[model samples]
Target: MSKEMQEKTIGFDSFPVEIIHDILRYLRKADMSTLYSCIRVNRNLCKLVIPYIWNNPMPNTYSLINLEIFINLFDEKDKNLLKNQYELDIDDTYQPLFNYTSYIKVLDPRGVRRAAFYWLKNYYVQKFPYSDIYVDFKNNPIIDIIEKSLLRIILKNSSKIENLILDFAEKYQDIPSCNIFLLKELQQGGEGGESNQSEQLSHGIREITKLSIMNPSLKRFDNIQEFLDLLPTICTNIKKIKFYDLFFIEPTMELKLCNVIKSQRNLTSINLTYNIFGLISVIRHQRNSLKKLVLRYIHHNDICLFNTFDQLINLEFLEINECFPINIILEPLIRANLKLVTLKIIDIEGIEGKYDLVESIIKSSGSTLKHLSLNIYVDLIEDKLPLSKLCPNLIHLDLKVSIRVIDEDDDIDVESKKQPTIFNYIDSLKHLKNLHLEFAFYVIGYFEEFDQYINFINFPSLRFISLKDQHYSSNFFKRWFEHFSTMFNKITFYIDSESDEYYFDPLDDFVQEMNDNGLSLVYTFDGYSNFVATDRILC
Candidate 1:
């Protein structure tokens, strides 16, 4: 070879297939698949690529080959484990695995069930340690073919299959019509097994720690207490049960969720986001055993309806959105039993400038809380509240305050920047990084850098910042952009538009006229209630 050719092609041609495959594994899956098709044209190329075909290990390790894949190709007892099984989706990154899978499958790509399993059996199963099995299979034509082949393969390998996760949505590939029909039996209560609470109780899923029933076909339940009772009995070992997008419009809906919480006496976490359950009805029950609770879309009602419940004694994390009854929420928690460490309250009203509940939580917890978040409607307040005393142990803080509105006729020189609007006290929170808000323009004037009032508080840990109609200097945002670490979750901005009927966004279109370069914008929306608005964080 010429000297230049020798130098350029040193290891490209002769490097072991494992090394070559590893180098190319991260290329776009489409590119890699094309390379695979070409590589198989030669014996040496086929041998190297085949051995490492199903190995992927960033999110989580996967043999990709298990009985789940080969059941259609082989018998239940035919597919033996070449080695142990392990899962590869450790990180919760929701990105497509197979690049350009739709084009190859001739249908929408859900999960990589078929190719991964086929590769596993044909090559790597006997060599590596595969203990965890992840089957979040999305349905596709090629994937369906592979899944049908893996059933027999899985049955033979299941005894060795220690952990298997079925992260599939409501519909899955290679599943029988009868199985889909079973889950949707309640939706269609005819010609099949009626969902008798006595017989179909939640017992079989005892070992499942995390179970998410997204787009569940089971809608209305005639048996309320019976279903809730089974929660504790049937899923005794379950730690989390996530119900996504299930709507309950019947009068008995409140009691259904309430009774369900009662049954989960041993559960440490519960998430009913996008479900039709209201917070008032769900929070009324005793959930002392719950350590984490997430409630979304409970509606923004400041009619003294939702009382701050102290019954959640063991609560460590609380995230509430599209909710209301601000004053009534915290008094009960302060007066009764409550232990919370993290709080995120967004898009509500009547929480103008109240720190009583937060203060109570801090004092009662003996400074155990590490995070605090608040997005309130406090345009009428004259006093800037004190959060330092309330959450003394706070490690992260986001406060958006609004001062009294300035009239159009008011003289520009008359409004002094030195004067503290309603939110002067909050600007001193220099120790925060993940800042969130739509600050009141005048409210933040007290901390204007022009005056010595706005001290340069360096939030070395500030990774994500949220803004909701709170006016802030873009210069300040660019500063935080440099300091935040890479591991920071989405640095989103949620902006809220205000109105008299409701302080929310009233824009037909967020028309942005870019003259030259793109700019950073944070927006949040809370339009559920006519009385209250939400903050949309746009980053």
Candidate 2:
């Protein structure tokens, strides 16, 4: 061997353990399959990657398989309980290489329940192939017991759990109550009598920082109320809370949820969706630390009660979607004089005074706002929008434009007249980096005129452009590329269509031509959404 070849060979394991662990961490976040492959390279790699795989397995595709592994990890006594009571045959001789349960740091009880039900269903189908026993697996008591047992095992063994997502959708009528693994029971050694395990369980519950509850049933609110009561005592450090589809929360349950919200020490983010009401007063408690707030599909009555938003002085990011009475929601936000960093208002159409409300918000937070997304009927606004003048610091802009002509035979240049009123300010946003435009269904022919206003000379700092159009026209892209191909570093065009019969042969040719001209372009048909072309210029 040459002197260079004779030198000590360095392998991945030769690196500092922390660096190797960081690389595996990145792989776990980007691609789990790749991280799984890394584990087979060596025992050292396996040790580092196993924890990532098991840390939050329930939320991933391999949850069912992970559930089986978790079941097998139960002690011999529990294994016997499973076999005798639930008819779940476990190989008592089987043992995992590592204590997999100890690695769980994020628990989704809903996912665990779903996985357990499916596992039980599969087992029953195989056992009684000729019967319809597995058809009613959702109502099975065995599934609930298995799910509770899994949660107990995880909470008993996990060193620290950071996030908990409770998603009890409509179908989940038989969600197990929280009494099975209450902090008191865990501390008293209710099941295993292992003080060390009990201590670990308590510590894990206390460490929870993020919690999400979705589609909670009103009928089962008592069990959820019990869980919420426990959260305030044990999960004081929770920084983020999300509630979804809370359409009919009783006054008592609402109060309980508010208590949980008020108890958090440094809560910064709250996402409320689908007809949530009477929580704004509770949210005001976190006004000092709250930074991000999202309200979606809020009833008009609740929007009127959003008057306390001005008190949230620390808020920087706010998103309102499908909420009516736009002015009521924006009034308080404007009064606060907030220096917001990001704002999104989507799916609020056919409402009067929207333009003025949006304009007021822009003028209020525009100085600090860096990201803005608006879904509105642009043609209805008679005056020019002052986006460029107010939000000068903006870096990203997403606009979903809608335009319709009342008279078909008017022969008026609606596109030329109305497009500038909405987007003429684009050129003045000097700091802008990304511009995303989604055209409405009625505005199919407006892209040609829309392209005329946007070009390389006007928007110098712009690097990325994303366009979502229902109409698939190759001519528009051809003309667009001719005008601004040299300007953008990357561009993504998303062609969304309701019909599946549309062909992309012409678009394919345009992409090929762009690729030949020193630009890398990829065209992919993504099901109902149709074609997407991601183009990157090869500088």
Candidate 3:
């Protein structure tokens, strides 16, 4: 090392305890997380830092997590820490979560059913003030302990939860059970049956609000009459309905969904995702009460589906995912006089096609639209969709861009070619605030002189940006921090993991070196899921 560089010293004990804590608090949570892992450098430092470390949303990278568990295995210490000291921070955009769900596997089919039962029962059976139950017993193999147990629970305590979400995935032995279960639950008892059990589990025609049956196995549900009886009660209370992943909403499924919409006067929010449900007639008819609509991943192969959207009057948030198979004409969807706050789409490949389609939508109804999320998979996005045009008033945009390259050759031609950045048109964005961009981690045109084509981004009021699927190295991350120091108060870097503690202090000397300079760190992402990358600017 040169004498000049060696002379740059990282001060130790240069500041008092209060100033040190202030500096540490000002640093990004990611930096804090990185710091906590290396706390063993000094025992006194460990005592001062470990408590606050849990408060930061850094990735739990404890190799000895089972050890962290061993340390606070009881309700006494851990619960106190969680309430008084540890702040539980949860970000939904981090893709998947890292907790226990990842570790546990289904060793047996019965185990899955048992797990589903307790989860669903606890989640749904609490609405004792309402009515109805939709236990998804379709194709459930064997009348095992799980089936008998769930059937008994619903049969005994049947009058609550107006809207029920059922897992209709096919298995076997579910036919006779579904038949017996519905008949027994929906059957009202005779006179003198108004006893203690009847008073609590009141069978005075339970009203159902909506039902979303998502399991695909439909061959076993044989109790049409009993299921239809529940439909009448659902019709009285249910406003909107959906049948996900089932191509031809069975004759019974269609009857039940349709009956509920026609019978329930206040129904709203009808979502039939994956387009397997061929009951657009029911969907269109319920347009008056329906406000939130979502249809995605359905290979409908029908142009009429797009043509029939004008019938929905109360539509608000619309999300159509992976609709490449279906030819979606965006014109009618925009002109339909419905208040749209959010419009999300997928498989819109060509950049020009997307820009043009969106331009037309903005020309028609873009002013009224507030939020838009689009995921496009293409090599290079052209003109970057001039977001200032269509979404001029847009607030939340979950924009995802995936560019596939063969390899890093870097031998491609230049000079005669004129390719600019995807953010060139951002100058006119006066109304945008929270902008999320998912692309490569590096800022393409950053760190250049005045001769450079693109200068800088100034989202004066912008607060949050979530970059999915982009992981950065330690050095690049530090440099990136210096570049965007002016943009945000909180910046989060998300990775794909959630296990392990992502919170650990980087070397004290390294942090002190940066502090001695003018760098400010804010946040860090280092879990099997999304945790906080905590850092902030110093100067």
Candidate 4:
């Protein structure tokens, strides 16, 4: 090696181990690719990077390969089970360089099931290339066996699992044994009834602080009920619980689920969807400790029940989505005098007293709120929303405007209507840093007015602005930037359209033009299922 390069390498090697470890940790958080490269540099770096890499392997595309590595870490008994019972093969002589499974801290069963499904599909496709057996691979019992085996390996080895997300949707029958496996793991007993009491007790199921359960259908309510009944006994320290798409819950099961919530000693956050029986009463039990509450698709008829929200004195974040009589829900919060740091009300439905309730809620929490998101009618925006007076401390604001359709036979003069722009109300919010605007449909003759509004406003702290669900011509943005390019550091356009015929030729030119001028502009095409990137600005 050259003298300069050798000296630099020696200097880096001489740094304290703690400093090196901290640098690697920062690299891992900032960029996974940089950390992966660091691990290849030397033995010391590899030792530090391996744990970060294996600590939470799911929620990534590479989890399928990570599961294979985990299977390789299995003991001889599991290896024999996979080969003899499940017709899966593993090299018995192979050993992992490190105890990789022991480093796992987050276990996502949904991701594991997905990886296992794909793994089995690939296996069957290769094993029976000419046969049609792989077509029905989803119904194959081996997939369940594989998933159970992998969970067993993780439960047996990992010292602690900090997060567990249980999503039993669509194919609940396929993995019926998962609850049993978890129960056994928590009880410190393995598949063969062998108890390793002291060692298994440290395996971290009891240490779970965050749990998410997405139970959409009632087909497997019995299975879910059994699992919910088991949680209060095993997991008492859970702080965050999320229930998604629980539309068909019965009264008895709801009580069991509520019991689980009431059992948590330190529960601070709860997210509920649809309507659960006696939900308000159950949440009242945790009012003193709960800090964040989210309610979605809440179409319950009992407006009197929401009065329990007044008891949540410690709540700092609140989100309500697609719920009605929104006025009744917000009334309790307004009376509660919550110092919310973040409040999001999306797709709220109500004809009477909607705006007043929202304004009141914001007025009550304005002193402490930093993030505010609202989806309201376009008519309300035209009437003017006094957000600056309601929430002065808001740093991030997201405004989504919905509009009623006007028929061609109508004689309403839309252009003559005095449509007040968002700029009219936000000029006083000096602390605002980010702004997001979403339009339900494109308003034809508003570009000129929007540009004029932008020219008059002054946002001192604003750095980023995002426009969603609207189609804007490239010339409009060109004209906009020509006048006020210095106003924002970055601007993104999220185009949502019904027809696929929309073209982006002019927008592409505008994006390239902005990049050449030392400015950042991004255009993203959003469809029902996926996002198509038209342009990206790399910093």
Candidate 4 lDDT for residue 329? 85
Writing each residue's lDDT as its tens digit, candidate 4 over 1-539 gives: 89999887774568788898888778767888888887787887688789888777764353345456666655566667778987775555556788877888888766666667777666666777877764243465666666666777777778788888776566544344535446464464344344555557667477889888766555645666676687788889999988887667667767877888999998999998887646656898898899999998887667778878889988999999888767778878888988889989886442323777777777888779899888766555555556777787889988776555558996655555535455676667888777776655564245345545556666566666655545455555565666545544444434334324344555556667777554444434464111111222333
Model 1: per-residue lDDT, tens digit, 398-424?
655544344889554324443343235
Ranking by lDDT: 2, 4, 3, 1
Q: Model 4: which ten-residue window has the lowest total lDDT?
A: 528-537
Model 2, range 225-292, lDDT digits (tens) per residue?
A: 67777778777899999988777676776777888899999999999987656676678889999999
The best candidate by lDDT is: 2
Off by over 4 Å in 2: 1-9, 14-30, 59-63, 66-77, 85-87, 124-135, 190-198, 302-304, 350-352, 379-386, 404-416, 442-448, 488-515, 518-539
Clashing pairs in 2: none
Question: What alpha-carbon RMSD in Å does predicted model 3 have with respect to the real structure?
Answer: 16.6
The regions of model 4 sitting more than 4 angstroms off are: 1-38, 58-63, 66-78, 84-88, 124-141, 174-196, 220-224, 348-352, 378-385, 402-421, 443-448, 468-475, 488-515, 519-539
Model 1 has a clash total of 64
How much does each candidate deviate from the true structure in C-alpha RMSD?
14.8, 4.1, 16.6, 5.3
Give lDDT per model, in order.
0.44, 0.71, 0.48, 0.68
Q: Which stretches of candidate 1 lie over 4 Å from their true place?
A: 1-69, 72-204, 216-233, 248-260, 274-286, 300-308, 348-350, 353-366, 377-385, 403-424, 427-452, 456-539
Q: Which sequence of candidate numbers ranks them by TM-score, best first?
A: 2, 4, 3, 1
Query: What is candidate 3's lDDT per residue for 1-539, written digit by digit as tens?
Result: 88887667644444488976765565435475556654665666655555445332211121211112211222243334433553322122333212222122111223334444443334345543264655553432221333444333333333443444455455533322443333343344323454654453443224445566665455645543356556556336665566677654556566665665666666677666655444555566666767787776666556776676777756777777666543354555655655577777755452324545544554455577778777643324444466677567777766665543325585533222222344554445666666665543223222222113323554444555444334333433444445554543443434333323343234223445655344333444442212122233344
At residue 81, candidate 2 shows an lDDT of 73
How does model 3 fare in lDDT?
A: 0.48
